[model samples]
Target chain A: MMAKEISKSNYLQIDPWENLRSLSKARIALGNSGGSLPTREVLSFQEDHAFTKDAIYSDLKEKELLKHLQDFKLPVYQFQTKVSDRKEYLKRPDLGKKLAETSESENGDFDILFILTDGLAADAINERAIPLLKEILPKLNDYKIGLCLVKFGRVAIGDEIAEKLNAKFTAVFIGERPGLSSPKSMGIYTTYEPRSETTDERRNCISNIHENGMSIEKAADLLQYFIKESFRRKISGVKLKASLPNQIDRK
Target chain B: MAYKFTLRGKTYSFKDLKTVLAKATPERSGDALAGIAAEDNKERIAAQYCLSEIPLKAFLDDLLIPYEKDEVTRLIIDDHDTEAFKPISSLTVAEFRDYLLSYEVDGKTLKGLAPGLIPEMVAAVSKIMRNQDLISIASKIEVVTKFRNTIGLKGHFSVRLQPNNPSDDPKGIAASIIDGLMYGCGDAVIGINPATDNPQEVSKLLKQLDDFRQQYEIPTQNCILSHLTTTFEIIDKAPVDLIFQSIGGTEKTNSSFGIDLKLLQEAYEAGKELGRGTIGNQMMYFETGQGSSLSADAHHGVDQQTLEARAYAVARKFDPFLVNTVVGFIGPEYLYDGKQIIRAALEDHFCGKLLGLPMGCDVCYTNHAEADQDDMDSLLTLLGVAGCNYIMGVPGADDIMLNYQSTSFHDAMYLRKVLNKRPAPEFEEWLLKMGIFDDQGNRKELKEQMLKLK
Candidate 1:
């Protein structure tokens, strides 16, 4: 039998969906050159991935972040998890959830505590954390608030910090895992009466906060709503339903 | 029972069959994380040697998780084909490996022996064999299934056109579907992983997929990968061709996913009642991966690869049209790098095919994992050679919603061109009629007719 000859084309065949690229960030309408991605598109994808990788390895600007936290006129404290460095933090997630033996802790009675950590993407916390806090700090001014910055921390670290500080609620502002399109996205996890043993089900999360995704103002509003409802119902997470009056219940 | 072997003047003893299986597994990060891996290479080889001498009947005698405690174990024991086991029942694990690689064991013999072999037995043999051995044995075994078109025929390759959107936007999904169709993909299914599990949103996406499929007259099936209960709640009102679920090996892991054998059976019945197939009626699609049970804290001390094999037993019970292992989607903590991902994908395909299930692979990796496009290309090429049933066909190999990179439409075309494979026969014919491909099966330039799909 004779082998079939593979086709070769000199120019790329552009997809008509190129007009629809604005509708979604998905990599659609990629013009092809004989069943393969064009040279420019391939390189463009690689460049975006490079940015994401860099973000994952980037360090949090703790000094700058701490200065920004002081603008709220609340007490600011810094802590570190048990993880020694980034490599260990990525390999052993269990270590990142525990407090370091030497790290200082604060004993304060507060209604809400905000803890910031540079999760998979430090650029997220560095770029958007302050702007979001500015939008949210005033709405929560009627109650006592404390700000804490952690290095090499995971989501569960907030549980331990809240338990130590004796706060009624904990709102964690951590960087999300960087996606190709949205490298500077942060996630907020709010839990009521948080303890070190708290599982993921006990916390309510609002993710994908960035310039390209959810705006800081919208996230602040959602966080405020969750805090008020949690205090009223004495619950959070799976049980605390986000039942806004304007939205219809799909169920 | 205790198993021991003396290798290079050092004696190693495993506490039980589960311990031996875990020790003998290839080096992976999940086993190391679970603290079940051998301390060194010599200990691993000793465990492999000890495992090779154990007879095939030993697995049947000693249950890994115990029949009474785990429904998966009970299913395996109750569904044993004793008569079919007669041919290789007397062979030890080493002998079984040799028997499979022998010249006489062709596709027909393998199919006849499939029901007789358990997941543990196949996983054991796979542990001792090389990557090429897995490929060679799997290429001979053809486990075909059908919904609207046939899959897993000899000299045929298929692609699951995964048009996932971040927010389930209908127009964005439609554009991706048309793009995939223009490249002659989506023969296996046009499946989507919805961002939310709301039944209303799932029903809307299902309706959009069904309408687009009907409008284009594409020879394929459509599925929305959601929780089993969500599908059941909307099965009566939606246009679902295949019921999709992410199944695991143990009862507890399935519980975490909120599913059980009874729920799976119920969903199967619902899909069967719809009668939504033109050629055949195999209407279940399952996605499994290594370390799912471990992630759920329910592995029961078994290795990830062995548990992955047991998941195939669940898929086989329902006779699924398509079953794939999202091999690398479970992060680096499970499969550290490219080498580990490739090994796990080959092992999954080999084990699934040997157990009489139609196995495919997602050929994907997460951004956090230490892998790149080169790794995906290598796995895709190897799976194509191993007679994989289907691979994911995302545009440009980037999944924006899930934030992972998988095989691309161009990767599928490259595999077919290099391996001399064609799409499912019916779908290939549809492509010809639609002017997507010329008579020689070479892709044609984009035509005006193709762009007028809307």
Candidate 2:
């Protein structure tokens, strides 16, 4: 049987700059013979999505992350959440926010409490967390600090962690929800006057700190500046503004 | 008998051919050209016919007319071409800005165009210019265009009644629509995003909304924000004014949503075949965002915001009736907080408008994100100044099923009152007829309007 004819007006128009397709990966100026993408691109996108989903589960990296803390010879504590596994952590966000029954409280009057957790992107935490801390830790060598590795945690978990540690400020370096483009992206959320149920406005977030994106030195500089400013201003988030370089010239 | 052809569906026959040529080129009256001479009129008539019937690309070939061409032929032919037909690649940002700010002609030389031809011009031009260059030009040109195909090209807005998962029932959805209309929305286009992707359910929901439009005598358009493929299958069977899809910048991202350019084209064609637009209005409705490409892993290392703009280039292809960016709804991973969200929203609006898409914004954020209504308020006001086409409307600016906060129905009213803008023409008339809006487009008595509904 002859194939059914598709009409011209049924598709998108031809993109005029289709020949310049190689310059950018963005789907621009593609010819307008509109239809679904070909099979290869479709399957590749699906595969990428699967990769993003898999980035959520990286238990093998947990051992290496803890070892890095031990090698730094900094103080470290293991904390558990009310949630049992990553599945529960994702399903019941409320459970992820609370501490486990066996979680013991430790009190230490520290300047900044750095809490590490594999929050949605474990690879982000494993790759960026220690490297970022390593760069900034020396700048604050004189200040008292507490470090803790947390499991199945959320951004708010830092508030409770800081309350128990009795820290002046809290910086939670957690893996952000991975995007298809950058699955190993990390976020550093800091808050002042740390306590449970603190409104998000009191928190400042610095995100997209991965190997390919924001460098460790810059991330470290930002986190240190935020902590210093948080202490100086007695607040974070909307109240305090981070000043950027006035001039930039891209190479 | 001289010659005859149809222009904009009207058959113009030539006996003396004066009136026919006049109809074809209203800018040049037959009498004006007639007094010149009989032979001159014939030459002008043939030129006018080609101008009216042939597209610019085809007409460019006329420059190569094998027979001797003179200065008179060039002046007569080129003068009639809409400035939009100029090879946009040669124009600098300033020149492009000037072209977009106003028609750049003495009068409405572009009156005879099919509805949504601006998209055609934008698509054609965008192909020649870099997206960044186009966006820069669009940003500099602060011109507010009427949604040219519709009544009243002034600033207009719509409230998409999102009857999410738990509230997908017809009665509940109808109640939301009533709630939206009570606050003086439904102007731009009353669209719905069904929580369920089931094609049958989507069709039923569209029918239900169409019934409400008829029962309430709503003069505006309606749609179900489902995937185009789902809508395409049911386009022939449903009362769909627009086919909706969540478009992104790359083919992979679009394909991830189970749609490709071919599917989008098919939907466009189907909507056209169904006579989706009231007149010749374009019939595609697309929603885009910054992180969707990254979310789908198709961003190819491009920044999320730039990817969002390129998606507009894709949207301009179909000459969409609406292209909205659900800016902050994607969560904190892409656009981390209020500052980032606000910046991205403004950029999305700016980029979309510059690309010549009828740009709207779902000025929204998720509970998980560190954003508040105040952030939305600031963005909404800014978008109004930037000439956004519309913004989403939900009850209290919150979608319970979708788990996000968006601009509320009252927000639309606030924008209209503050900005001194009105809804689309037909919806504006309905508002006046229902006594919801006064002649000045202010709320007459919204409490009374609600009470009447009760």
Candidate 3:
């Protein structure tokens, strides 16, 4: 049998800064046995690697998700972009940025288009998207809202979805890129008059929505405030700044 | 192949050295430096001066006794006419010193020298000037000696204002620089790293910085982080105070940056030919990180910490004025988070200093990395204790362009107060002259001075 060649550095037994390792989960203090990552962290890193991969490639359960939408009395529209499968969606970003020609929304006219997308981290959208939307919808009662459920989509896909819906603003709740520590983090990207021409500057981002991140109630309140401010100013992103109720408005 | 010598219990090497010599100054003439060593004795001269502070002219005149004028003239007259040696030999010891100090070689003077000489001269100097601590080669690069006085001949703890971005306008960059200066940053050099790699864009930025320096009469060096080759291409068109490059631990890792030992030697020569240092000073600003080799997939199976120390060995070969290890910037694949970052930073500083390089820490973290300002605070304080040469001075410690957190201009002020340190000598003079800070470093009238620029 061939000898197994280890990829990591040799593990050392004692590291000088091992005492300082207590402050963080970062790999610094793991005393290298010979000269590399300790066996436990190597295994732990491999496990986290598998966990992040599963979170990114996992698909949403359509029937169970639709049940939550029905329970909230939120009308949902299922849509796809030009990219047909998850593989193509990951490979071709431009395809993910536009809607498929056959796609159409029943509720086309609204003040805002709310989209929940499975971007890179599908498990995050499957677990946290609906509950956060349920809390956010009540606070956004002042505006006419349309809901779109997107599959194999990214944040930019919402720009095309909102353009088709003829909504003035778009709030895209999508899964963020999974970090080793936080696999299920979500992000909200809000844009005014989003279109193919829209750049990142036209969209405002609020991120890190998960159990370990921003709570659903706080994200809902913040999203409501941003949407309200975008409507009042007729702008978002670089031009409009977000402020808490207790803070002074920069504008 | 290691031409190693130890000073203060630490060893240093002078391998593949080309630009480690001192520039000509009024106190030391460029011709005298050229005469001190010939092509045959480069290592001998380096080993001799690597651990002693006796001025070269003094070493030759007083210490190098019974020296034949013809033999010395043979060594000194490289390209110059041998008749040039006639005036040099007849002079008394003091007159020879005066002649060497007073003469200018190609519009420049030599303040200090690392002359390439024979083993005989190296032995002579070593036998005579056996000072315990060889004054750092960095101090000899410039004429003014006060810059290294406070740190006891070690390089001062300094900060470089890194006003970075692609679309950053001149006015915006200037504001950040002013903010840093007001808070006692930019002692090392006020440098900018433009997001775009275009040579024209980088040259334009250097032009604006030169204009700013001239307008304020700022008495420190400036740079834009362009590859040394790119800098060589543009230095003729624009002024660059230092040739900036990022080096790594392994030869393979350095190769990934399109650099090798030969390229480094060539870049050093190119920088010297350009002569961009602020009036005959050393001209190299290098950055390294612990995880950079592993991040670049060139760790070569050696551990990250040992690889980082090897990078310092490369840096000291050129005797750079600044070599900053941007600790924690590479992120989690190598150094996981704050704890790792803190440990690696101290290690980098300790290792760089041990190798006789003026080591600094970026003391930075990215948002994606599990780090925050508090981690930077702890690391900065610790590195301060470790005698860090410098840290990054980004406004608010937040780089809007890179979206990373580093030490702010305010953090530098805090370090200065707590550690009883100040910026490099010239910058301290500027601060005191501007009346922004007092003799005790108390704020005299910040709003009045800073608002005037805006």
User: Number of the top candidate by DockQ?
Assistant: 1
Which candidate should be chosen as best, given lDDT against the real structure?
1
Residue-level lDDT of model 3, residues A77-172, one tens digit each, is 788778788656554455667788898755467788888888767788889988888788877767787777877776788777877778889999
> Per-residue lDDT for B1-454 in model 3, tens only?
2235554565556441211121100111111222322233443444444423333333233312123422222232232223323333343322322343342521122221222222222222222221211112122222122121222123346788887642334555665676666666777788887533346767778989888878877777788986665676787788877789998766667765657777788878777677555445577779988656554546544345545665765676675878889886665445556876876676566545534467778998654455665788888887776566789887656564444567766677678778777777677888888765687764444433343433
- Model 1 spans with C-alpha error above 4 angstroms: A1-12, A66-79, A101-115, A130-148, A156-173, A188-207, A214-251
lDDT per model vs. reference: 0.86, 0.61, 0.60
User: Which portions of model 3 show Cα errors greater than 4 Å?
Assistant: A1-251, B1-156, B449-454
Local error of candidate 2 at residue B149 (angstroms): 8.2
Q: Given candidate 3, what's the lDDT at residue B374?
A: 70
Worst 10 residues of 2 chain B by lDDT: B25-34
User: Which ranking of candidates, highest TM-score first?
Assistant: 1, 2, 3
Question: For model 2, what is the error of residue A23's alpha carbon versus the real structure, in angstroms, after optimal superposition?
Answer: 53
Per-residue lDDT of model 2, residues B291-406, tens digit only: 67655545444335544655775676677777789988776655656776766676666556654556778898754455666788888887776666778876545464454567
Which has the greatest TM-score? Answer: 1
Per-residue lDDT, model 3, residue B405, is 61
